[model samples]
Target: MIINFSNLMFITLNIMSTLYMISANCWINCFLAMEINLFFFIPMIFSPNLFNMEMIMKYFIIQVTSSIMILLCILYYKNFIFNLILIILMNFCLLMKLGSVPFHYWYIEISNIISWKMFFMLSTWQKLGPMMILLYNFNEYIMIFSIIMNSTIGMLGGLNQISLKKIMSFSSINHLSWIIASSMISEIMMMIYIFTYTMMMFFIMMKFEQMNLINIFQLFFFKKKMMIMISFFIYFMSLGGLPPLMGFIPKWLTINKLMENKFILVSVILIMSSLINLYYYFKIVYYMNLNKNYKINFFIEYNFKFSFYLFNYLIMTNLSYLLIYMFYY
Candidate 1:
């Protein structure tokens, strides 16, 4: 139950990085903040026996390469034609940092090797700075391509994966498409997407951590807990952007705005890819429900405090659309 010094340091540095990002007045400042954020997170991955050195090395190399590319873009911003090229390169670097589509290989590889806490940060918080930067200076055509690639790749990537972490990585990529699309429409919509996505992922990661569940097959261990299974069904369905759930609100708003702006084709693509992602979500729930006849006593009981928290979280997630409507309208 004791806290480690590295954990404490990571928290402090993460906060500082976020604050710097929020208050950044120039590209240089934002880049430095991102560097600090990456440096701090590297230490969090440093477990003596459990950590994967190869994954750490790959992450470091990719991120550092992107950082250097960003710096070069900033340095050579004066020329007219070269500036245009640099801007495109900058967007690529940011997209790479966000682990979107074609640049997501490192992310999937690293996610499989990291601890759940680090995975939570990587999947959620680590996206904030780069995404914010992308929103500010994004190219319209590039963004459209990114949206298509992210949605298509994310949906296809998770189809054959048994590892829960790999599945979640693809889910993150899928959600990244929606988030990027939202940003193209409105800042408020983008913020809403980020918040909902973070909350849903946090809850899912917490449940997985508690159960020590890392593979889709391991979900069978909790087959007796109907309440937990139902909660997970709702959670994953919401994440897949099903209607009347917390996750759909941002997507609904985004599609409305896109259509208003005459982006009918993009909206259709988004819908189709989301349906593909939902197929996998339902697959996970089907697997969980399949072993219901097994009467093994492997079900773990939650403590009173966690049980109360889980109940509230379930209720809140299920009814979250009402809250969103009340706030927005």
Candidate 2:
């Protein structure tokens, strides 16, 4: 009971912090909200493992450094002549908070040491405060540079990674670029992208935890399970933003918005990078399907349990929401 109550408290505080950041009218308020968020979330991820200790410390140091920089920027944000420099400084600080490139090294490194649950928080909920604050003073040139670097680096970074955690970390960065792009067009689109991403990420992280998989090679063991492979295929494809999937909708809308706004170059880069991202996702799927020596049976066994159905239900829910979104707009 005590543990549950503590968790509930932390969760409530975390949500409140994000709300504060979103509703903040000034830079100081945003900074305070971010700090509250950072402090509240730290205790949730606490564990006895030595790696967790290392990861927590690293995370703490990075967040503090960014927070301090953000505070300093707010203090010196008076001169119009140095407005551009201040904008760059503030955006860089928030990007560091969001784990966007080129300040993404700490984000990727710490991902390898944390549990799936922690990583989920790191990639999804933890991003909301910083992202909302980033919009407070939007910088177009820096955003474009971030989009280009994040997409390209995320794709190339994931291609050579064997650890699922690191791959997802890079993928998270890639998705961050999309979120940033959506923010450039419409905050509503950014929220939509985030909602879909959080849903997909939760499901994927759950699947990984259920299977106890850390590396891509472990996926080979599930080759005989047709349902598992099919589900994984669906997840990866959606994540890669393939056509007719829920994930593709946001990207399509964002790219369309970009083109409508005359950001043709950004749209083109996003498309090409998405294709490359899909290549890696498909490569992983290919590994799941690879079995030359064994005669694979398509439906030897069906693990039609609650979790399996729940996963399907989640996918259907996303598609249903997409349908509604499309119908409305």
Candidate 3:
């Protein structure tokens, strides 16, 4: 992996943007940080290959429009009715940037064309600043709407997709719904959800990149590696929020919080959507395990580090019951 000057600049800008969001005292500064982040990300997306011109244009237009909307909201923060409208607009813009439901088409399109590294950033890190800002100025009605729509859309959108990237894109949206729901109850829970989600996505992205896989059919080529197959099973199933997995911990906590707050309908909707997601996740695992001829490849290197990290996460998740008990007791 060779790092170039532009890549270095991109990393610098990303850091600055994140720092600004963390330290921002006002909405103006947060908006500026997001702008800087978007400006730098565009170059990073295009620098790898110029053929991504169309995708780049789409990304730029969407981000710039969102930024402009956010700016208008900031400028009109005084008038009650006007401010409410602007705030709703601002929420919609941020949702667009986050690639949540109804605004996720552009993100899915772009994900198919970009490198897995860029996609990883887009799926995880890129969401941080926008999510933080949205959480800070949280709106219950808008958040509830986003939560239901995003979860439902994410579940249904991925059911027929052959592209791995597209599947993950919808999965990202599904997870966003949970993250937003958790944020409504507790910021700490939301942060925990983000951390766990990022780690899971990172592991899956690295595996996909390592195999140079882009679609479901490509997974068959690596059928000889039982380790890889098992890992994939664990990772994807965990992502679907199966019990006794790291992904389930945050979800379980979120449900508890929701129930405590009498948000029964939201909790039920979340669980139903998760079950829909689990169907696809299981389908992937079944496809991977359909064949049983194991061949050893000496040339292929394994990701021992990530595997160990994942194992640790599994152990920690199993112990989470005790942690919860201690907290409650």
Tens-place lDDT digits, model 2, residues 120-211? 98899999888888877878999999998998898889989889999899999999999999999877888889988998898788888888
lDDT at position 215, candidate 1? 92
Candidate 2: residue 81 Cα off by (Å):
4.9
Instruction: By lDDT, rank the candidates, best first.
Output: 2, 1, 3
What's the count of clashing pairs in each model shown? 0, 0, 0
Q: Please provide, for model 1 over 176-226, each residue's C-alpha lDDT reduced to its tens digit, 9 standing for 90 to 100.
A: 999999999877778888988988888788888888889999877664565
Q: Candidate 2, clashing residue pairs?
A: none
Full-model lDDT for every candidate: 0.84, 0.84, 0.84
Stronger candidate by TM-score (1 vs 3): 1
TM-scores of the models, in the order given: 0.91, 0.90, 0.90
- Model 3 earns a TM-score of 0.90
List residue ranges in candidate 1 displaced over 4 A: 49-51, 293-323, 326-329
lDDT score, residue 34, model 3? 90
Order the candidates by TM-score, highest first. 1, 3, 2
The stretch of ten residues in a row with the least summed lDDT in candidate 2 is 292-301
Query: Candidate 3, after superposition: displacement of residue 20 in Å?
Result: 1.5
**What residue pairs clash in candidate 3, if any at all?**
none
lDDT by residue (207-283, candidate 3, tens digit) is 88888889887666664565576688778878898978768888988999999999899999999999999999988
